[model samples]
Each structure stands twice: as structure tokens, then as C-alpha cells.
Target: MSGFERSETDEFARGARALVIYPELPGRASVGPEARLAESEGLALAIGLNVIRKKHYRVRSPRAVTLLGGGQVEEIAEMGRDLEADLLIVDASLTAIQQRNLEERTGLKTIDRTGLILEIFGERAATAEGRLQVELAHLDYQAGRLVRSWTHLERQRGGFGFLGGPGETQIEADRRMIRDRMARLRRELEEVKRTRSLHRARRKRAPWPVIALVGYTNAGKSTLFNRLTRATVLAEDMLFATLDPTMRQITLPGVEKAILSDTVGFVSDLPMQLIAAFRATLEEVISADIIVHVRDISHPESDAQREDVLHILRDLGVLDDEQAGNQPRMVEIWNKLDLLDDDRRTELSGMAARDDNILMISAETGEGIDAFKAHLTALIAKGNDLRTVKLRTDNGAALAWLHGRGVVSRQYVDGDIVSVDVSLSRQLWGQFEKQFENQIERANA
Candidate 1:
């Protein structure tokens, strides 16, 4: 095996170096080349690769063989050799043929954007379900590159006179193996999805509403989750820092208790394979009663990042312009206020004040947290009903159910009957009525 084969396991070793490149094609003016290059470098760093050199090339037209001009390829190859880079990271999608050709010409291991993201996900996945999802996605991505991986098996082999002329090729055998693994992974993932559905059903039977945190990658979602729940998650300034979804019970101002779920962050050009594989995980966002979109207001590309997040949400059916009234309510959390200047902070505060669904706060400084909590409490209360009911003293289960599912204000015992004042959401009230119909003598809402 040459360096290209060893590069897979040794490229991220202590002394190994990598060269990063971003191909800026014509008519791609939404995001600048510098920003793309920086993001690519960040992706490389997330995997512990030592990025030695970063470059951007303006390509008029992409070549099918190498995806870059001959001169550009040669120049990049020369730079990689000069820097002693063990691998090249390309911030663009490449076909298997293009990747093989590039590696052959440059004598370096090469990876594209999708492959890079998949590697990050593979490295950061901590839970069993997360690992399964990552493996499924990796298999899906690798299934398409079998043609380049097993070219040696393309030649026919001599066999017995009556036996087959070419048995199964290496490519076919590998593809079959990948397909079998993918099938098993899909079955496991389906079971995981079913388990999640049961969990969600249990939560529904309870009274607490679920609030999910969603935003662009590294946009302070984990910070806000930690601030609200006071539980430390990996809140770092890195892309895809939180891959597995985490749920914690939090108390709102007047709401008593609510479940807060911190989920994986979104990014521009997210791989479709990840989306398909992690659909079970992202279902949390779709099932949440309220979706809180946390934004890093200090970043220069905040608006663009917000659009990307919204686009992913729309694709997931969590946000729909046509049926906006039917979907779950959304709140915009302008986080990282501490990073801004005094004047900009004041301006944002004024803007948030004018919108009922927006809150400007700093999770790090605990600024405006009380107000955000109060707003969230009020939003949750909007769907609840204050009611008074009477139950028999012997029905302790009914009383405990009410206390667990709702906020009980006053209670009085008279003879064998108990009078209770409580607040419950419409759904909980319906459940209560169904479960305690005979025990209740009178009810008023």
C-alpha cells in the first residue's frame, strides 16, 4: 500500500499535516470564499487534523477528471508536497472518479465535504443510536464509491472448466456486504425510532410541555440549554458539538415543570444521508410543543445561518408557511448578547421588546433570563384552563394524578369529599375527565 492507503489512519496522527482547499465556482456568490475556507478549516480541526495550508481557487468551469484545471491541480500538489501535507480536504462535493483521479495525480489522500462531515459525525457520536445512524450514513456514502475501491477485481480469473468464467467481482461482493450492513442498520434504527415514539407518548401522557432548542451550528444552543437546565453539556465553539439529543426537566416561572431538549445543530449544505439517517433523532424537534431558535447574534453571517436553519426546519415539516397556524409555535432567542457592544445590545433589546415572540438574552451572563422565563411561562399558560373539581377522599390516585399533571393551588377536605383548585392544559384536562369520570362529583372550568 502507498501513502494514500496509510493516510486514512495516519493523517490525523500527531506529526501529520493537512492542506485545505475551497473551490469557488462561478455564480456561487451567496457566501464568500474566505468564509467557506474558514469553515473547511474548522471541520478539519474538529477531527484533530493539523491544517498547515489553506487556499481558495476561483474555477470558471469544473473539470470532470480532477474538478480543477491541470495547472491548479499541479500547483496545489506542489504546495502540499512543500508543506509535507499527508491529506487534502476539499470543500466541495466530488464524484468517486474525480476523487480517485485527484489522489492519483497529487499522490495524497483526498476527502470531500460530505466525507469530512461524515467523519466528524462518526467521531463525535456517543450514543448507540447515534453510532448506528453514523454507520448507516457512512455505508450509504461508501456504497457509491465501490467502483473506485475495487478496480483490481475487474479482471477475469481462470476457474475450473465447468465453473464460472469470472465469479463475483470484488466490487459486487463489497457492494453486497455494504447493502447487508445497511439493511441491518436500518432495522436497528427503526427499533430506535419506535422506542423514541414510545418515549414521546409517555411524555404526552404527562403534563409538562416539551421545548426544543434548534439553531445553526455553534450558535449558542448548548449554552442556552446549560443556562436554563444548569446542566453542563459540551458547549464549545465548534461545529456539530452536540450530535445526540439531550433532554432535561426545567421549571418555568409559573409553569412548574417542562422538558427541554437540546438537539443537533443545523448547517448549510447538510448531507442528505445524515438527514435520512438521523430522522429518528430530529423527530424530537417536530414533536416539540415550542421550538426555540437560538442565534449567535454576534456572528457576521447570522442572517444567512438563520435562513439555513429555517430551510432545514421547513424540509422537516416543522415550519410551513401555508399551514403556519397548525404548526408548533416558535420563538427566536437572540443569544450571545454579551459579545456585542453596548450600543448594539441596546438596539437589539429595543427590537426584541417590539416582538412578542423574540427575546434578547445572554446565556453566559444570565442577563434577561428572568424575562425570558416569564415569557415562556406565559406562552405555555395560554393553552391551559383553570378548573375546580371534587373527588372522593378514597381516590388518592386521582388526587396525585392532578398534582403531578397540573399546578394545584388550593385543597380542602370536607367529610368524604376533597375540593381542589388546579390548572391544566386542554389535553390534560380531557385525559383527567376520561380517567376520573365517576370519582368527580362536580367540575368547573
Candidate 2:
């Protein structure tokens, strides 16, 4: 019952000392090892772990047993002992055998990047659906690592207290139990997905548009969300501070209202299990009419971070393979301007000036927020144009359709004719003409 086998309360306590290590592999040069180590440290701190020591090693060839060289493993064990650390946090995914070997050699509880992120999610998940999703993902992860990771699973148990036949290994019983629980979680999550689809459909029928805010973790997305919507979500400088999806109604210039969604941040090497488990929540991003990509302009790896976010968006089918503008309109927001110096800020402003779709703003200081709102309004109103149509008094269905799909500015009745002025998007306008061409007498666009 060691490590993850125990309840969370008895596992890693708050303020537990931790030794953070990053393995720098060959042919991986997107981000420097130092920056990646810093991010890993932030993740450790986010889970309330006291990072006593941090270091990185160049792994010319990763070892199958420990993922690190024998000498490197010895060095880490000695460092952990000297630092009196309670945990060893590896900034890479490890197999169950590799993890067990590392724990035996390092003499400290060991967890990898995926496990650490899962722990943070398990803690930060606020809503019931979030907890369920986390549990399902945790179960999925633990299902394959039950061999030597959990010592209690080595025992044999009888049928009554176990899951399988009369004489079954506890590991088998535990695996069976996990499978059953996972099946139930999938069913429950399916229901949640159905519920989300219903809500999305209802919003689709509404006249207002949907805008989603997406970015790297702790990239000032929640800050921008609060700044725009005036709702107090937990805006912290910690990784994964927000896990569940939050939505609010906001009014953009030239638009009465739009649904704004603040979703979980994206990261490099995001666990595939999490991506699959949280599909119900990420669907909000897929159905968004517009996507606002928020970036931490002050971070050194901002460009790399942008690529990571875009990669995830593409994975979610929000973007096409060609990326030839056949997807939702997207705008890149350069946030955290307050953290940049004058020279860097000026340089970025020059770059943004050349890009029509990029906006430089400080979400915390409200700098350029008015312009941001106006730009958002422009994107929303891009294809919509004003049209005046005269219809017969009996064409009630067409009038209702116009009201449901467009912004009806004016309507008047004269004799047997009704004149209506509406602003409709190009797609909606095309639908209107196709559906009600015979019902209208005259139309001017």
C-alpha cells in the first residue's frame, strides 16, 4: 500500500520536500532544458510541494531500467538524501518498471510528468464533472501500472472481498475493479457529454455568438476573462490554476451579447488520456464561433507556447490541416505586457502592428482592452450585412427565422406588405434567401 495505493491524504502531504529533475534528451531543442525545468518546478509548487533541489541531466541514451544512467541515478539519490527530500519528480513519462526501479534506487517516492499533472488536476478540479473526469483519467493511468508500483497488489485474496474468482491475485482483482469503475465513469461521462451537447445546441440557436479563450497554463487567460467579464475566477500565477470550463455572458461593441468561455490551458506533451477524458469540456472550444489565443508575451518561450496551443487546437479539429482560413476566425492576444520592458514592448508592438490579427495588450492593466473589444466586435460582424426585405403579411415563418438568426433592426407594416431591416451573416443571409425567396416580394442587400 505504498505510494499511489494509499489515499491522497496519506500520500504526498502539503509542503513535502521534493527533488525536481529534468532529463534532457538528444534531438529535442524546441525549448531549452532550463525553461522546461522551471516549468516543472512551477508544477511542483502548484501542488504545494517544497522544491528543495532542482537539476537537469543530459541523457545521451535513456536507460530502460531507470530512464536515467546508473551514475545519474546515484547522483540523484545522494542529492535527495542530502536534501532530505520526500519525493522525486521526473519531468518525463516513465514506465511502471522504470518508476519502480527509480524508487528503489533513489529511496524516495517517485512520480513522472503525467502523474504530477494528474495530481494537480485531481486537486484543482472544482466541479463534480471535473472530479469525475479526473478520476476516470487517474484510473486509466493506474490500470497499466499495477505490477510493482503498488506492493499490496502482490497478495492473494479470496472471492468475497475481491473482484474475480475464488482464488485470485489481488492485482487481478484490483485491475478488474478498476475496469468496472472505468466503464461506469465512461457511461457517466457520456451522459455529461450529451448534456453538454444539448446546452451547446441551445446556445447555437441563440442569436449571440460564442467566443473561447485558450492559451498555455498561467498565461493570464483567467485574468483576461475576469477583466472582460468582471467575474472573479481564481486568477493565480500557478500552473493549472483553473481546470473546469467557465462561461459568462459579455457584451462586445456592435454586438448585444456573446458567450465567452474560459477553458483549461494547453501545454506541451499534454496527456492524451486527459485530452480524451475532457472531450466533453473541450467541445466548447470546438463549437466556438471565434477563438482568442492568449499568450504570455513576457515569457521567453512565448513563440513555442503559441505553437503548442495551436497544435492542441488542431488536434481538437478546430483548425484544418491546411489552415487555409476554413475554420473559426482566430485572434492572437499578446497578454502580460506589464511584465515586459520598454524595449521589448516596443519591439513586440512593431511586430503586432504588421499583423492585423495580432493584438498587444495588458489584460491586467486594461491597456488596449477597449481596442480588443472593438476588434472582437469587428470579427463578429465581418460577414454580416444589412438587408431590407418586403414580405407578405402571411409570411410569419420567415420573419421568425430572421429574428432567430439575425439582428432585426426595424420592422413596419403597410397594407398587406411588411418591410423588415435585419443584419445577417453571409451564411445566414444565404440560408434566408434560399429558404424564403418565394415568400418575399422584394429584397435589397
Candidate 3:
């Protein structure tokens, strides 16, 4: 038996022992095998799977039937038997035939990387939209694996004399069911997307800058969000602690208020199913004015993780070539600075000083947070136009709107008129002009 076991009578106990395998292929060495293996273990642990052992294999050629060589399959089977593992987790994509063959050979339930991620998502999805998306992705994934024979398919079904000749085969029937269900899920998700778009449109009309926080999983994004907004989101030291997007109103140093969105974290080779399913949620990031990319600087794979996030962002069209002119500006926040030694921290601080876009901070200890807020305020202000305007004292509504929507740098009341200096984005200025067309006496920058 494996070192970890659960009692038979424990109702809440999880008992499956898993063997994790990461296969390293030639010409694909961006991320090291150790980091990949560690990530695989984290995924397994996220869903309460007891990973008893893990291994990295260098594969010259992947087998079509089993994905691993015959000798490797035999060796892994023996290892599984020795450790009494009931589950085999391959940290690589596998075809339906390859998965089935491996499961049959090892006498253990086998799941590839995509399947494992889908399973974790299935378990972690909490919101109605999240659940619907997960179900759609799961159906799409399972539709490709309907190849097993069933005894019921051998039997004939009685139907209307003229309506049918023979009942559908088990695989065909299952595939049809999956397709129908997927269609329904897609319809539901479409409604979700439409509703989300409506909400975003409403926010756009209000015209507050939306700042989105995105990063690799467990990169202290949630922690930074909590520190910045004082909102009690679930910030845990685990992979994917926060799956759903959460937004809050945050006030920067010199900015009145902005919407801060904390989004789902990215990972290396994030499954396509997840990316497709979570498109609506990720759209929040797409429409942001500023993208704050939080990084766990203390992690050994931080650079690799950053590349993965950038790749995903590009794929999502947030960082696309076509949208380059209008794409949101990104700020790199090197978080977890408190974990580094004094010398390393000083080195990183010096590096950040040379780049205005990068800010080093420890979200847990509140270091550099003040500087980050100031930096954000300056970045936002840089896009606005400064103007001086005179308004009537009776136009209190317009004055309040100006204060609410823009930065009022100077204000003074003289008799029946008010003079103010304000900075406003082009969109906000356009709205202001439409609302107070006649109230303005004179305006100059």
C-alpha cells in the first residue's frame, strides 16, 4: 500500500493513489521537467488526489497506441502495482486510444493533462456560469472518448414499424447525447456572455477606468487584490484558489475611483477547453484599460510563467497585433519581495527603478504598495487632458459630475461663478461636453 491511506468508514476521506508522469520530448525545452512535474503534482493535489510517486521520462519517440514505449509501459505497470496506485496521471496530452491502451495495460484509471485539468475545473467551478462552462468543456472532452463497447448495443430495440430499422450503437447514441447536451450548454453560455456584455456596456457608459489583475496561478494576485481593495476574496497558498472573476471599486493615490478586476490565473499549456469555456470571464481582462500582471518573484519558474501568461494573453486577443493600437497597457508587479533576502531584494528594487513599468512589492507586508498606487495614478493621468473651465454656481449637478468623473486639481468659487482645473479622459470630456454644453462660460488648457 502507498504511504498515505484512508479509513474505509471515513465518509469524507479521499483514497485514490496517483502516479504522475511528465514526459520530456526533444526540441521542446522551454520549461524544465522539474517545474512541469511540480505543476502536475499541484494539479493532482488541487483535487484531493494522493500522488504517491512521480517521474520524468525522456522520450525519443512517442508510441501511437500507448504514448510510451512497450518496455516503459511494463515498467510503469510494475511500479503502479508495487505502490498500489489506482490512478495514473500523464502530464501530457493523450489521444483517446492512447489513454485506453495505457489504462488497460496498467490496470489503473489513466488521465492525461487536459483530462486532469478538466476534472479539477469540474470540481472547483462554483458559480452558475462557471458550472455551465465546465459542463460544456467536459462534454466536449468526453465526446472524443466514446469508443468503448457496451453490452446493451448488442440488443435490438423495438420501435415504430416505419420509423426505425435498428437502434443506434452505444457509441453513436452516447455521441448524439453528448452533442445535444453540448448544444444546450452552448446556448446557456451564450446567454451568460450576452448578459456579461451588457454589464460591461453599462460600466463603459459610467466611464471609470477598469484595471485587471492577471498572472500565473499562485502568483499573489489575489493577495495583492485583497491588500489594495481590502476585500476578503479567497487568497490561499494553493493552485487556482480563485477561479471566478471578482471586481471592486478601488481609489488610486490621485485618481478618484476605478474598477479593479481580479481574474482567473494562467498556467503553462493551459487547456484549450478551459480557454474556450472561460472566454466570457476572460473578456473582462480584454476590455480593461490597464492590465496589472502580478508575478511571484520568489518562485523558481517565474520567467517561464511570465512567458506562459503572455502567450495566453496573445491567444485571447488581449495582446494581439491587430489590436496593438488600442490594447491595454501592462504593468509588471513583481510580488513576494519579502521572501527574498536583503541583497536580492535590493537588486530587484534597483532593477525596477530602471524600468518605470515594473514595480517590486511584497503584497503580504505592504512594501512598495504606496509607490504602486502612485505609479498607477500617474499612468492613468498620463492619458487625460488637463483643462480649465468656468461654471455657474447654480450648476451643482455638473460640478458634482466633474468631481466624480475627473480629477479636480483646483477649485474656487467667486460670486456666482466657479473656476476649476480638471483632468479628464477624452471619453469623459466628451460626455461632460454633451451634458453641460451651455453651462461652460470658457475653457482652456
Candidate 4:
């Protein structure tokens, strides 16, 4: 099997003997030590893949042809052949040449971390936008192995041995085709962007607030989104169980309706290519007036995961650099409080009260939900108050102008005049001022 055939083989099976390779310092001395093998197996099981047989390898020689000695590769291949294993899943980046070479030697299909992720995305993508993003990422990864099928083309040719030409060749044409498809994908995503803007505009008109659900994968974002909003989105303990973004109208404790959006979960070492692919979806976090940094307080790396999320947010320019002296309106949802012991929960609660922009609550058991709602209500009130204006309505045009640019909270009408109160952004206020230039000019005159 080559190219497309192996690509097809990468999917799940009922009784697949899967060998997950997590390389360590090779030849240092070890005996079949599985590096995170159980974790990898659990991840596979989440996607319905049955892993029957498993093994691990510790290889040194970072640039070796086999990543190990010839004897070692032969021994491993012999084991696979003896056990009739179905797949080899390497939990690291692998070059096309290395992949093809390994598969040929092992007589089994080979895949890397990137390919496995793309496979999962392909299966989980629920919307047109999600599918397009996955396809774009897949194409970027696949472009490197255009001629993996034809080894003849990889042989020493006119220019460079095993690489052929100095600059480009037929494989370059395949890369160009991928680029052309990507450009078209970018254009299609622009339409998705426009649709997202329209949705944001509609949400901006909502009487409540917008709270975005964000955290590491399987940190229970969807469960919290469902509990808070009475939604039925898929909530499971799996890596990337949710692919598309889902939004629901929630009634918080203060009788306030808020739009709670469940976003794609973050992971450790979220591939750069996948990040670029899913940038459009992540703008939800950026547009979010308030961010709910839900955490799996039980996870060993929970602190590091929180740091990663904040780092990415700041890098994207969404996180403010200012001290934000005012009570941060940003609620830290200490989700999965149900998972913590009473003492741990008490300690965290005290910490949250002392900290700004932090809220401690379990989205699953509905614990501390009232406090979460109250905190959200206060933030919403503050966010809405960021801009407000009172206007005398002698000029119908000015009234009409403000109406287009913002939401009208109150209106009063009397003889030959009208009084109106509106809430708007400063930028929108600028637009209203531009639209009513004639009135401003006459007043100045």
C-alpha cells in the first residue's frame, strides 16, 4: 500500500494490533519501557479504535535512516510480522521519506502524529467550515509525500541523487496544486468569516451578555456549556470530542440571558499547522467579551495547560496588556469542582475570592453556579456600560443615525422633539457622528 491506500488504512478498526512508538534516548539501556503508551491507547479507544497488541521503542541517532540500527528495525518488523499487527502509530513527526522507508521495511502502513490528528478532525468536523479547515491542514501535510507511491522518481536522477532536481520538478506541480486549493479554501473561509460577523452583530443586539467557554480538550467545556445553557451538545472524555463551535442562549442566576459558546478545546503542543488551520474558528475567543477559562483541576498538567491557553491568547493579541485594575470581569471557571476533594475545593475557593477575574465553580455538578452567574451578571453590566449616550431628538436624522449604530435602551417623545438613550461602541459613535455631519456643522455654526 502506498499514498492513498495507506491513507485509507490509517482509519480505525475493531481488532487492530497497534504499535505506538514514543521515542526516548536510544541505546541508553531499557527494556520495553512504554512511553505514554497507555495514554496513547486511551486516546485511540476514545475514537473507537481497538488496540490489541502494543509495543514501544527507544531509538537514538536523531538522523538515522531507521531511527535505530538495521538489526533493531528488522527485529521490530519481525515481531510485527509474527503478530500480524495492523498499524504502526508513531507519536512524533516523521518525514515522508522516513515514513515510506519504515513502511517498506515493516510491511505495514505507517502514520505520524500530524496524520492521526487530521484523521480525527476529518471524523469530527460537523460544519462546512470545520471540514474545510481540516482539509486545508491535511493538504498541507500531504503535499510533502506527493511521490511516496513512486520510488523510481525518488532515485538518483539528473541533478541531485534521490532528490532529482536542484529547484523543482513534477512533485513541485503537486505542491502548486495544493497551494491553489488552499487559496480557494482561504476564499471560502472568508465567506465563513462574513457569516461569523453577521452572527456577532446579532449577538451584540442580544439583551444579555456573551460568555465564551474555553479550556484544554475534554476539560468539560461542552458539559459546562450544556449545564449553563440547557444545551445537548456532545460531551465526552476524549481528545477533541467537539469539532464545530456551538452557541446557546443561557439564563444565568441573575435572570440574564447570555450567549455561551462552546469552542474547540486546546491541547498540549497544538500543532502549528492545525493552529493556522483553525484560526478562523478561534476568533470566537477573540471576539468574546468575557473568557471562561475552564480547567481540569484534576489533571497533573493543569497549571501548564492554563499557561498555554493564556500564552496563545496573548500571542493572538486578544489578551489585554494593561493591568486591568477594575475587577476583571473575566471569570475563571474552576470547572470539574466535582472532581476535587472538599479541602482542595475550599483552598481554591479562597484563592478565587482573593484573585481578580476568577470564579470557582463546577460546571458538572452545578456547584457554586449561583456565584458564577452573579459574577457574570456584574461583568455583563459593566461591559454593556462601556459606552452609553443620551441624546435630544430635535434632529430626526441624528436619532435615526444613533439607531443604526447602537441599541436603543429608552425613548421619550414630546411636542416637536424626542429624547433617546442608546448604548454603542465609541467606534460606532464615530460612525453616527459622520452620518449626521450636517447637524453637527449647523450646531457649530
Candidate 5:
């Protein structure tokens, strides 16, 4: 609250100012009450809003007009008036009437948790796919707030956006257009899903293994991935910084190649609608041979972020029963080690050394990065096909194809009997057989 310390008494400043309100469950303080509220406030701050103030009031009854006390509404209104704040940021969804009444009393714009999140998503979406998803979500969230818009629409009554028509109040028409666009976005996304599936099929037939980097937003997954693969991804200090999955083919130290996929970071309480909408884009993580759960070792909420990522993995059906049952190859990359003091960095280093599957590294400064890369190389070596196959000299075309398309182990030749041994996938072997049919038949003949 004290950072930068800007005053909001002026209208120009107040427009950017927000008042965050979180509901305190009655008589129960064991739910880490302060932490939850602080997390909510943190989300508001991350959404690029100026949180001028925040407060928590007890929720006494479901039908209560005021939050807690009889005159609590007016009290809050007076607070708003004093602060000159134009926006009330509620940490829970409000009924349309509730929102309108709150706005009427406070003389300020009122938005709830859903609306604030939707606004953030709307602003952060960059790609066509991302924009479509965000627009659909905004429409869905707006549909529930129709009552608040009805009066505004009656006065204006013009269909400015895609929601309503000329003759109808914008409220009714907005809902209709939302439904229509939601349907269209679904169709387009389905086409995208099919295309993604096709691309996945092609990758599956190839010999390279895939490694997907996933974690909470701003957990340094993209930064780490960029350093590892020498590919640039938009690394930012904001939520949902990278919404699209970016895959790059990278070669590790042992001459092993793998596709590195950097996916959108998972967040706590991510909307279900959004998960369903962008699940196709997350297929890279879902199907990876190995998942690297990157964590911000420097962050205070690192443990909580890890929990969120794990919960999302469970929800996405990525870490299924088999993964839970065994010590799967999923690794935890404890990133941002540079942010830690010497004592903390040493402690994390000790932990990482004790566990083969956990690595502590500073992805930004390349500290301990070589060791991390070596560990990845080891994982890929253990996970991939290291078996060597020797082809006969009679299969000359196949030999040429292997040299052209594969990582060869060794090659030897005698008259009419050259042989090449290489490490490749079973699928690649099938393709190799297909490529050498005539030579194989001739050798048999």
C-alpha cells in the first residue's frame, strides 16, 4: 500500500484508484484470512490497477443490504468519497442489482472479482485465439450484469459494440451477440484444435522427445526456457505474460535433440471457461514426455504457486493416476536463485543436490544453468531410444536416408554389404523399412 505513494483525491488520479473489498466469513479466522485478502489485493495490483485502499468486512447474512453493520454501506460510501476513488473492486461476484446499488451509493464504478479478471484478460490477450477467448469470456461475464447496463442503455440506446442492435436496448442485444460470437469462437477453436492434433501427430512420428516448461505466471518458466533453448519468448513481470505455447527444437549437451515447449503459466482460481477455451493451446504440456514445473524460489508464495500448478495439472488430467503412483520423471526447476540471499541460495542448493529431479538455478544470470542443462540431457538420454540398429549394405538407399534423417551411431561397409547402426524411434524404424523395401527384397532375393 505504501509503494510509490500516489494520492487519489484528484478525479484524474481517482479514476485509476480502486478500493478492494473481500468478504470475511463469519466467526472463522482459521482460513488464513489475511493471506487470502492480501492475495486478492496482489491480483488487483498485478492487473495494472491502482489499489488506493482495501478493507474486509464480515458477511453476516446472504440477503443483507450492507456488508456488515446496518450503516456499513454508507460508511464505505463516505470512505470512497473521501478517497475520491471511482472504482470499488469487490473480491467476490455481485448480483447485477447489488453492483448497481453499490455504484449508486458510492457514486463510483463498481466491479467484482469476475469483472476485474475479465478486464485483465481482455487487456492481456494478444493473438487472435487469445482475443477470441477473452471476448467470449467478457461477453459471458457481461451477460450477468445486464441489469446494471439496462438503464445506461435506455439513455444511450445505441448499439455501439457487437452486443446489441439499433432498436433494442444494448443489454438484450449484447447477450444475443455474445452467444452468437461464443458459438463462432467455439467453431474456430475446434478447427484450431484439429490443426494442433495434426501437428502433434507429425511430431509423434518423429524421433525427438518433447519437454514442456510449465508453472505459475511470472515463475520464470519463459526466461528459463529462453536461456535453455536460445529462443526468445516474451518474458514479463505480469500475470498471463505468455498465453500461447511456444515450441522450439533444441539440442542438449549429449547430442540429443528435444522439442522444448513453453506454455501459459497456470494461476490459482483460473476460470473454468478459460481452461476449456485454451486447453488446446496447452496440449503441448499435456502430452510432453516430461514436464518441468518451474517455481520462483525467490517468491514468498512459491509453495502456494507450486500447489496451484499441481492442482491445475490434476484438473487438466495431465498428471494422471500413473504419475501419482510412481516416481515419474517430472522435475521441479527452482528458478530465480539470484534473487535469494547467500544463505537461502545455499539452502536451496543443498536441497537440489539431495534430489536428482530438483534443480536450483538462476535462469537470468545463467548461474547453475549448465548443471540444469546436463540434468535435462540426462533425462532425455534416459527417456529416449539409445538402441543402435545396423542396416545391411544391400539397403544402400536406406543407408543414405539414415545419414540424411538420423543421428547415426556408426557405419561400416564391405563389398555389397555396407551397414549403418543408429539410435532412432520405433516409428522411425517403420519409416526406414518403408524407405528400403526394394533393397530389402533384393537382398532376400
Candidate 6:
């Protein structure tokens, strides 16, 4: 079988039983152990794993060899044997030696949180650029763990390719080869980044504003994107359901056309390798005209999820203090109202009513979408400038440009000159001056 097809049958087979463990360290963790474990289980399920058992252990001090203490490791090994688990998934980062020791003790294939997430991204990334990024991340992650059998390298199919099947023969490769492959992937990704930058530049020259939807994984971003743009995108009740960013043209009140983008979801403790690999994709958010933060209001840890999303945004420089005044117009959306009880919903509604920046809606039921669109329209038109300009009657290009770039309120022809009144954003105004300023007779603002 081909590598990818083999991955489906071998790595993510229908009944591949897995043992999931989350180590809860003491101190102030924003998210509770229960919520964290639940999220981990959801991730395991997303990969087609039958999680036979899940547990959370409190660790006062972590061991260098194994993240868990000796007693805890022995208990896990015993549990694995009892449950007949084929895989042990640790909900934390693991060093190479730690992973090796765990596998030896438990006699089950082991992977850490980063490895699991990479596997999922590998399978879900549809675009060529996305695949390239995933591959690069996979290589970076596996480079350190090469001391273990490299059988996982054979598992590369649709994803970064490291989840080897049980009883598979282990293979070893020189680190030099891995280094060379990673270097090449970085060069190719850089090219992709440049091409993406050019596309963004062209869009900037265009008249349409860009709106990006960002939130925690499976937070209804794709659903809301579909609701607003009337475009069908993959919206499922699973973690990282949408990996590749999708963009579409949408019309808002008083705006002819606006670009809407649905981005990959953010999770707490997302691997740094992924952030670096997907920087090109995340740049879309940096260039957006408006940012809509979608939240799953029904989730018990909704507030903590919000903080995780914001932390990533800050890391992306979106929430930097220097860019505060210049940042994109921000809107917070509370989604999945249908999943909430009436009392809970009423409480949230009151909170949203008190905050102009927050809006409550159910994307599936089409509740409050009109108000959301109107709010976007107001934000886009907030600082627009109204101007009147005169151009030669024969200058049809300039007239068309004006009509396409902004909302034209009136147009009149007097002899060989055309007089028009229009509304233009500061950005569009600058572009007009650079492109057609000398050709115009005069402009009054």
C-alpha cells in the first residue's frame, strides 16, 4: 500500500486502542485538569483512536527520565497491559530518552502531545503549502527522537508521517540526512511565504477589506465563516477540523465586497515548531482589516480558551502595545447559543448586552447574524472620507476605478469633465493618490 493509505490502515486503524494520560502539575494552571484531559481525549478520538482508558495524575515533582514518578510509570504500564492498549499518548512534551524508556516499560508505542498534533495536521492539511509546513514540523520534531527506531518515517502518508504501527521493524538513519531534508523544506516554505506575501500585496491594492476569524479549535469558526459568506466549508464537531485557511468574498452593509478568512484553530500549549512552520499561514491574520474572535460559549472552560487564543494573538504581535491604535478592528463573538441552557444563555446575553464589542449568536441556527454583519459594516466605515473629484470625460478608467473602490453617491457630467462624489477608506485614498492623482482635475474633501 502507498504510504498515506498505509497510514490509514496502520496508524489510525478503526480499533487501535490507546491509553491517554495527562500529568497535572501543581500551581496555578488556568485550565483545570479535567478540562485538559477532556480536550486530550477529543484529540485522540479525532485521530480514530479508541481510547479505552483516560487518567490524570498529579505530579509534585517531575523526573528527568520519565515525566511521571517510578510508581506512576509502573501503574501506567500495568494499566496498559490490562487494557490491551496499543498506544500510550502522553498529554505533555517528552524527551527522546523519556519516550524510549516509557515504550520499553509499557511495551506500547508512545507519542507526546506534539507528535499527536503533528500527525493530525499531516492528515488534515489539504493545500500544498500546508503539507510543506507540516512536513517541516514533522522533521524538526523527529530529529531529536531519532535515537529511537525510525520506523515512524515509513508512516509518512498524508501527514508529517511519524506514528509507526505496532510490531513494525525499526529503521535508523543518519542525522545528516534529516538535516538536509529539513533545510530544503525551509527554503521551499520561504518561497511559499514570498508568494503569499505577493497575494496579500495585491489584495491591499484592491478595494475590499479583509476579515479574519480566529478562535480555539472546533470553536465554530468554519461554521460562522460559512454563515456569513454563504460558502460551504468543512465544519465538524472535532478538534482541528479545519487546517488549511479558507478565504472567500463577502458583501457587508455599505460595502461592495469584503474578504473573509477562516484560520486554523489555536489550542493551549500549541507546539512551537508548529508556530514557526505555520507563520506564513498566520500572517493572514496580521494583514486583516478586522479580526473576529469566535468563542464556544457552551464550553465549560470557555474563558480559559479565550485566554489561550489571546496569548497566541499576542505572540503573533496582533495584541502588542505598540500596535494598539493601529491594530485591526476587533470583535468578540459568543457562538453555540443553542448548546446552552436558558438560564446560562440569559446570563451570557446580559453580559454581551453590556459590552458593545461582544455579540452572542448561534451560527447553526442563524441567530444574530444580521447584527453581526451590521457591526462589521460600521467598523469598516468608521473612518471613511467623503470626497468630490473632477476627471476628464474620456477617463473612463478612473471613473470605473472610483466606482469599484468605494461607494459612489453621485455622478454628473459637465462638458468634458465628470464630477463624482464618493466615500473611500484611508487605505484606498492613499492608493488612488499613488495611481490616478495626476490625471484628476481636482479633488475636494
TM-score for all predictions?
Answer: 0.86, 0.87, 0.89, 0.73, 0.78, 0.86
Give RMSD to native, each candidate. 5.1, 4.5, 5.5, 7.9, 6.4, 5.1
Poorest 10 consecutive residues by lDDT, candidate 1? 1-10
Q: Candidate 1 at 85: error in angstroms?
A: 1.2
How well is each residue in 1-445 modelled by candidate 3, as lDDT tens digits? Answer: 0110111111223557989999887776668899999999998898788999999998889889998889888989999999999889999888889988998999877888888777677667778888888777776776777667222212322220122226766566656655766787789889999999999999988878889999999999999999999999999888888888899999876467899999888888888888998999999999898999999999888888988898899889889766432344889999999899989888778988987789999999999999999888777777799998899989998888887778777899999989988889988888899989988988887
Q: lDDT values of the candidates? A: 0.82, 0.85, 0.82, 0.67, 0.69, 0.84
Q: lDDT per residue, candidate 5, 200-228, as tens digits? A: 88887665678899898888988988898
lDDT for model 5: 0.69
lDDT tens digits, residues 329-372, model 6?
88999999999999999999999998788999999999989999
RMSD of 5: 6.4
Candidate 2 per-residue lDDT over residues 123-161, each given as its tens digit: 888888998888888778889898746643334233224
Q: Please report how far candidate 3 places residue 126 from its true position, in Å.
A: 1.2
Model 2 pairs whose backbones collide:
none
Collision count for each candidate, in order = 0, 0, 0, 1, 3, 2
Candidate 6, pairs of clashing residues: 122-159, 156-161
List the lowest-lDDT window of 10 residues for candidate 6: 1-10
Candidate 6 ranges with C-alpha deviation above 4 Å: 1-12, 153-173, 321-328, 387-403, 407-422, 430-444
TM-score winner: 3
Q: What is the overall TM-score of model 2 with all chains considered together?
A: 0.87
Off by over 4 Å in 1: 1-11, 149-166, 321-328, 387-403, 407-423, 433-444
Model 1 global lDDT (CA atoms, 0 to 1): 0.82
Task: Select the stronger candidate by TM-score from 1 and 5.
Answer: 1
